[model samples]
Target: MKLHPVLVLDRTYTPVSIFSHKKAFILDLLNKCEVLQYYKSIKLSSPTMDYPAPLVIRIPVLLRHWQSPTPTRRAVFIRDNFTCAYCGKIVKDNNATIDHVLPKSRGGTWSWTNLVTCCNECNQKKGNRLPEEAGMPLLYKPKRPSSFQIALNRWRNKINREFLEALSLYGIIVDKKKLPEGSR
Candidate 1:
């Protein structure tokens, strides 16, 4: 599937609204919206109800902004690159789990600053124990993922060349050079 260029908010990476190819063309000319990534074309039924047309789409300009680093298991794992915070071992997405720097029982609250991604083994070994107690320490402090980072993860499967270029203009650098060989 081909990607359609979409516009996302400058720092927030939130979808404001969607634009048709015709609309995107005008916005690109007017500089009101910057493109992020292109999504696959979708067929929409014609207003006359007899036919469908494939059209390019883009993110809209009026999206809501919110805080970053929403603390959730998936978000933590993605933020930590699916690697165990203590050992640096990469884990599969499904095998990743959230670990607390400070155990909940010891007054820890579920927040981005206190959570890290871990493998099952590390989680089991460190269960309910403070990092110091478990003889483990995080390689880096945990924090919320940026809006751009979260949005990139969400749209990775649908991104295309034009979208990548557009996002670059907004300073959302995607490290194409570091992608694993053979990875899409």
Candidate 2:
């Protein structure tokens, strides 16, 4: 069966993480979490009972510690909104390349601040040189995204109006138009 992800919020209503629907359902069954919303068209059935598939769940306690995800090619691309950092051209995933703001040859570590999503042309043009050295200034400064931000971006396509509304109740405002086609 295809496993759908469920948004997980803390007691304070802050999104903390994501869990598989099955995991979220189990959390609900064990009283570990409260179901906030359910998938409209999905249902989980058993021999004795049928349950709605959870789209969002909330835990009873606040989670204080969470680890940030390591910067990766896809994550960098997503963070940059698939737009080249140097030229501002939107590129497809297949054509997107990760460029080091400070060239790797110049002792640049592969960190979030150093990496950027760039198109092949920009990558080739800025090869082995610093952004300033190549006369290409970054449009925006790159920084480490919070763990929740990473999770939200990764699961953006699965977020719907209901989930967004629930998030907004907690002061998390996501642009509906930016969501993937069907989700909006």
Candidate 3:
């Protein structure tokens, strides 16, 4: 019951984080946040009255500073949806290897635009070679992902569909089809 997920939002209603229901309810109790939505109508009884469990809550100040994930192995794989850049094969992150789009030997750097995630087989096949040289081509050009994009992509699966729908009402569209097969 307490383990249910809760979406935390800023005063402006931008999503800030996901907290457990217990913490979210605590926030409501402390007057730190206002409940915006409830996961269920079923309420918990206290000495005073019924407390509706929160599924989403909003705070009272703008959260201008949003935390973004740094570019790392897991970040790259998640950003790429664990798909090979050249072959578009859906694979697990454990099986994915970071490949330099322009081979490091050819002066490629380890930045987002130059790095892509691929399966070990593809990495071996394309070893130190340009995609074209390896008779393969990238399915899409890589870019440095925004922190919001990175976090969203990371917790994509953990996000409830109802929460996503609620976000949609605020004009945030998360398209999973443009990404790999396994992602929502």
Candidate 4:
């Protein structure tokens, strides 16, 4: 009795609702919307019906807009590859936690630049102290997460032929070319 999940997006490209996968697919075929992914199906039924209906989960297509990624604990962990910023070790199995480079009490706000993924041990030891105060240095400088990058990350694992084709229409694709020196 697995159920499919769906993500609904508003006209402005913001996530607004989630629906059954079957409903999403139907909408896509009817030209009412676009499909983001085809997730596992779930059995659904009406109270008055004897049999269950199968549904698949999906995300709605959105209009293109230049927007920045929202800052969140999950986003930070993904952006850092679940690795501790100070120790450079990957955190897994529920051992990862979000840390602030500058303690919030010391005037740090919840933003991507000030937040990072850290192991429980590091977070506990670095409590309320700046990295420098704890003799720790960040392996990478943090910056606001990019919306395009976040979108790619979210869909990378689930991408398929149709998804790739659709994304390509928006100029999104994987490139292996090396940048010329001094380009940055």
Best by TM-score: 2
Q: Which should have the higher TM-score, number 2 or number 3?
A: 2
Name model 3 segments beyond 4 Å from true.
1-5, 16-23, 26-32, 41-51, 59-68, 176-184
Clashing pairs in 4: 2-42, 3-42, 5-57, 8-17, 21-56, 21-57, 22-56
For residues 25-136, what per-residue lDDT tens digits would candidate 2 score against the true structure?
9999899999988988778999998889998889998887754668988888877778899999989988899998888888998999999999999999999998888999
Q: Candidate 1: deviation at residue 93, Å?
A: 3.8
**What TM-score would you give candidate 1 relative to the actual structure?**
0.63
Q: How accurate is candidate 3 locally (lDDT)?
A: 0.77
Residue 16 lDDT (model 1): 36
As a whole number from 0 to 100, the lDDT of residue 141 in candidate 3 is 96
Q: For every model shown, what is its TM-score relative to the native structure?
A: 0.63, 0.79, 0.73, 0.56
The window of 10 residues in a row where model 3 has the poorest summed lDDT is 175-184
Question: Positional deviation of 166 in candidate 1, in angstroms?
Answer: 2.0
TM-score sort, best first: 2, 3, 1, 4
Q: Which of candidates 2 and 4 is the stronger one according to TM-score? A: 2
lDDT of each: 0.63, 0.83, 0.77, 0.62
State the lDDT of candidate 3 residue by residue for 41-100, as single tens digits: 446668998887787789898766655446688889878977789889988857889999
List the candidate 4 regions with Cα displacement exceeding 4 Å. 1-27, 33-66, 159-184
- Give the clash count for model 3: 0
Candidate 3, pairs of clashing residues: none
